[model samples]
Target: MTAITLIQGDITQQSVDAIVNAANSSLLGGGGVDGAIHRRGGPAILAECRDLRASRYGRGLPTGQAVATTAGNLDARWVIHTVGPRFTREENRSELLASCYRESLRIADELGARTVAFPAVSAGIYGWPMEDAARIAVETVRESVRETESAIEEVRFVLFDEQAYEAFARHVR
Candidate 1:
């Protein structure tokens, strides 16, 4: 069974097997959720990212690249960092953003993690409309949960704004 929840607060605060960061291709740091994660996850996260960025994957995030790092102050033990393209961008935002959720679960499964939390990707600096983003997010996670090998127990959409929270709540049940 797939259980999805909507919570209001910092996405960094959620305690789960893993939490996703709405990062940029660089993986160093960017606006919105990316910046918050970098700020709270501490220097180690970024330091590791710098090296990962240089791989064949390079520092520039490929669509499905979801990397893991130790959680510094957050309740989670690990952080699954994925770069999600902005919906407002002219590029194929849907597929890339969907990759963020699906690949995150894939990474979690590889790590044997059962629970994960995600924020509203691309809704901040990326400007994905709340209604559409919530639908895409819920659908992507629901679909990913069904397809992945990971024993995913729960997926959360943690919203920092009330409107976004309510929009997700409306779609999740």
Candidate 2:
């Protein structure tokens, strides 16, 4: 069985096989987790992202889609980048949000990663309500494990603060 764990700390510091970044469409680097990963992971990650942009992801990574790059200085061996959709009342984007986790895990399985770390996708500046984000994240990951033949054994949600931790904790149970 896949174990789902929640930790209130930095995703970059976790010694997992891969860390999921709630990245923007550019995948070049932006604020929040994107900026933090780029800053701490050093230039190699960015360089790979640049190469991705120039070749495969020229128009930018689509929302709900995921891709991987070198982890650079981060403890993890790989960084799985996924862009979450912006929240809107007119559109039902829960599936898109779910795809972030599913796609990341798919990539992780391909990389032979047994452990993965993630943030609450789109719950930050993307304006997704914390509770809803947590619900979607937890439910999707759990469902993915049940539905797929993945190599991942441990899935960790690394919340940056106590409030985020508590939000994810409520849904985890």
Which candidate ranks first by lDDT, i.e. highest? 2
TM-score of each: 0.91, 0.98
Q: Which stretches of candidate 1 lie over 4 Å from their true place?
A: 89-92
The lDDT of each candidate is 0.81, 0.94
Residue-wise C-alpha lDDT for candidate 1, range 1-173, written one tens digit per residue: 76788899989788887888887888888777888888988888887787777774563877556888776677787888887665654555787777778888898888878778899987887778888888888898888888764487788788999999998988887
TM-score of 1: 0.91
* lDDT minimum window of 10 residues, candidate 1: 56-65
Clashing pairs in 2: none
lDDT of 1 at 13: 80
In angstroms, the error of model 2 at 171 is 1.4
Q: Candidate 2: lDDT over CA atoms?
A: 0.94
